[model samples]
Target chain A: MLTLHNYFRSSTSTRLRAALNLKGLDYDYKAYALLKKETQTPDFLARSPAGLVPVLELDDGTALSQSLAIIEYLEEEYPDPPLLPADARGRARVRALAYMIACEVHPLNNLRVLQYLATQFDQDDQGKAAWFNHWVHQTFRPLEALLADSPETGRYCHGDTPGLADCCLYAQIWNNRRFKVDSSPYPTIERIFAALDELEPFRKAAPPEQPDAT
Target chain B: MLTLHNYFRSSTSTRLRAALNLKGLDYDYKAYALLKKETQTPDFLARSPAGLVPVLELDDGTALSQSLAIIEYLEEEYPDPPLLPADARGRARVRALAYMIACEVHPLNNLRVLQYLATQFDQDDQGKAAWFNHWVHQTFRPLEALLADSPETGRYCHGDTPGLADCCLYAQIWNNRRFKVDSSPYPTIERIFAALDELEPFRKAAPPEQPDAT
Candidate 1:
């Protein structure tokens, strides 16, 4: 059994949950309130030094931090429904797409970064939303171009299968809705998000579907 | 032969270069001046839709984007000296350590992000450096703790051999020097970085050694 320590609204947590559901792996869900700084506790910090969400605790008490790393661990350990592609090039493509969101968009729009903006720069809600949308569009523009132009993109960000990139893409879309970011400009991304939203695994991973959604 | 498209000072580029050097792979280095908006050119954007540097052009003209993804591809295609450990848990540990820098620190302290603070928020050099150091220390504290306490850690981030995490750590240390960040607080990181610096593979990949280095 695995114990997942996470918050509902965290896009990274959403990614891990989607991956877990897709793998058909059952786990114990433990919620932490991000707004109240619950992850800043000594216990949580002991589990994940960074004190971020989606720490997958194994039965042996081995805690895996970082959503992508955990998902990769699951992929390797389980290997039943692969989140990455078979070939090296294909896997590279999927991981690259996943990184675009994971490394670019989500990092900038993370709650901590947003709080930094508010505290350090005196940015208000409007200013923070602007900052969020700026990064979202910056990466989303190129992401849409890559996905739309590639012959490799099928029902998901990779092939016909829902893989690593789709997990990131699906989670990001849910995060995007909070700012009311218009997806009309990215038809390919919009289509893929729609397709992913239809799937039970992804839908169940949505923020609103989580136990701690508030 | 592979063509490495990158900027001399980009930490991501440095990561890729270190990986290539470690793997004993030869590549034709193609420099892009990030400050001059060289990567924003139509030609470069065609190669990498994200308009980012360190695109690995394969023999078949396939351009791979994202430094970590490219490194993973190199590890898979040419497995002579494996960059990742053989076990799944080891790989997860290495990748998590790498992502702590890649996803958390680098994204926030990137050149463009600094420029954003300058242009959009009226931040000067002092402010930018403060911003840079803030994110660096935020992650480095836990990173230092993780490295110091983990029995899995050896000469590098995972085990005695240098691998994925070392590449990220080495590049990040170089990036930190630009801001003149004090590394003394993290003795473990300082020691690992010093060990890596002594190696020819890592020494050759330093920013000052790049062809287009200013």
Candidate 2:
């Protein structure tokens, strides 16, 4: 069986969990609390050199990290209930949408980045909130424009089916709500997210529904 | 024909250019100088909602953004002189290595981010350099560990061939050198970079070789 090493509230982990559920693949879950620095432990570091959570260990002892890479692997290996689109251009659009959130927005607001800003730069709670919200807006504005203007956008970020982009969008929207980011500016995202929330896979993979959620 | 709208010094642009060259594909180069904030203009923003380079505009007018996604699209569409390994797990390893540099390190040291540190946090040049080098070390340490330990590592990040991981590694190492980051720490990365440097495709794709380089 596949084993997933992840934290309940981690956005990347949530995305991977939803992808796995959507693919109907069962996996063992291993939880690590980021607040406690569990990922930095020597043993965990042995499994993942990056010391990040949401590592998927294969049955043959190979471990995979990075949520996007892991998802791509799953898409290639499983190839059912596909997370990516069939055509190359459609796949590029989906991947670009996913990267807009994962690489651009999420990286800036990651827990480690926030801590660095606080301890190194002396940012107060309000300052931290502003920093978080600033990136959210910067990314969401373009994202909103893309979704609103693109003819390819149907029930999801791509066509009618929910795929890789939706997984990332759902996870990011959840984080946006947690950080109290105003969603009023992004009606397209809010509408698509609302649709995704009703799905069994997405509902089952939500942070609050996780076994280790606080 | 393909048209790439990219800044010469942008690492992501460099990587994509190398990928295109490796596939023996020719393209029209539209240079945008990042230091001049060319990416923020209205026309560019219409094509790329993210307002970033390198935007790969296809013949049919489908503009693709984000270097990784664009590269993936090329890999799928072109397929010859493949930038990915044959097996699924091998592709995952290469992608993870690439993302480790792209998503983790490059985002932290991006031009806009460095500008934010200077303006918002009152960071001086020294402080900014420290911030940049800190992330470089943080990422390279684990990266060095991963590359040195894995037997799959050949002349490149994977077996014998320079693929997606090498493209990212080459770009990042160039940035490291530009910022005077000490390369003594990552012998494996240095070694692979040296090998890549000797290749015509990589050499042709260097930032200095771009039409916009001043």
Candidate 3:
């Protein structure tokens, strides 16, 4: 069986869960207590050197780190119920949107990055929270405009079917709400989330629905 | 012909250049002066909302953003040189290594992020330089250790052949030297860089070799 070594609240982990469920793949969920820093331990570090969440361990004893990489691998190996768009151009667009969140927004607010800010810069909890929401709001505005105005957007971020961009959008929205980000400006995003909420796959993949959620 | 909208010194742009050269693909280079903040213009933002460089426009008039996405598209479309390994595990491992540099390292040292610390946080040139080298060191220590101790690392980062990981590794090393980062501590990394520097494709893609280089 495929085992996903993940943390319930991690946006990275959330991405994997949504992808897995959407692709109709059955997997075992193994949660790492991230708040307690279980991810930093030697065992988890051996599986993933960077010591981050969403390490997907395949049945053949292969451990894949990085959520985007793992998702792409799944897409490559399992072609049905495609998570990405068909054409190369569409794939690139979907990937670019995903990177906008993965590379630009999520990294800045990750637990490790936030911890570094707090420890190195002497930022208090309030300052840390402010830092987190600032990036979220900055990215969300452009995303909202794109989803609301673009011809490509349908029930999801890309089209009527749920795809790669939707996977990222859903996970990030969950993170935003958890942080109490004012998502009022992104009605399109809210509408898309509502659309995703109606789907059993996305709902089943929610953090609250995961085994590790307290 | 494919068109690359890029900034000469941008790490992401450098990444695309290396892959394009390695694939022996011809591209029309349209240089945008990043220092002048031309990337924020409405024209540029239409293709990439994040207002970043290294957007690849294909023959079909479809634009691709994000360096990694562009490279992957090239790898998939033109399979002659085969930038990725054949097996799924190997592919996942290579992609993970690529993300270790792209997501974990380069995002922390991008031009916009550095400028943000300078203007927003009152960090001076020295402070910014410290910030850049800090991430390089933090990521390089583990990267060097991974390369040095692992038998999988050969003349390049992954295997004897130049692959996706090498593309990312070379770009980061080239940027590190531009900032006058001391690379003595990472002997294995230095050795790999020396090997990569000898390659014609890697040589032609170096920042100083670019047509728009300052």
Best by lDDT: 1
Candidate 3 chain A lowest-lDDT run of ten: A113-122
What TM-scores do the predictions have?
Answer: 0.99, 0.98, 0.94
Candidate 2: the clashing residue pairs are: none
Preferred candidate (lDDT higher): 1 or 3: 1
Q: Tens digits of per-residue lDDT for model 2 on B21-133?
A: 99989999999988888999999999998899999999998799999999999999899999999999999999999999988998888888899999899999888888889
Per-candidate RMSD vs. true structure?
A: 0.7, 0.9, 2.0
Candidate 1's residue-wise lDDT over A51-147, tens digit each? 8998999999999999999999999999989999899999999999999999999999999999999999999999999999999999999999999
Estimate, for each residue in A1-214, the C-alpha lDDT of model 2 and write its tens digit.
9999999889999999999999999999999999999999999999998899789999998999999999999999999989988888899999999999988898888899899999999998888888899899988999999999999999999999999999999998888888899999999999999999999999999999999999
List the DockQ of the predictions in order: 0.92, 0.89, 0.60
**Candidate 3 segments exceeding 4 Å error:** B149-151
**What is the C-alpha local distance difference test score of each model?**
0.95, 0.92, 0.85
Please give the lDDT score at residue B21 for candidate 3: 93
Instruction: Flag regions of model 2 displaced more than 4 Å.
Output: none
On residues B1-214, what C-alpha lDDT tens digit does candidate 3 reach at each position?
9999998888888888989999999999999998898888999888777677888988887778889988988987987797788887677777877888898889888877777677656689887888788888877877777678777788887778888988998899888987889999999989988999999999988999989998
Fnat (0 to 1) per candidate: 0.89, 0.88, 0.51
Off by over 4 Å in 1: none
Binned by DockQ into CAPRI classes (incorrect, acceptable, medium, high), candidate 2 is: high
Error of 1 at B65 (Å): 0.3
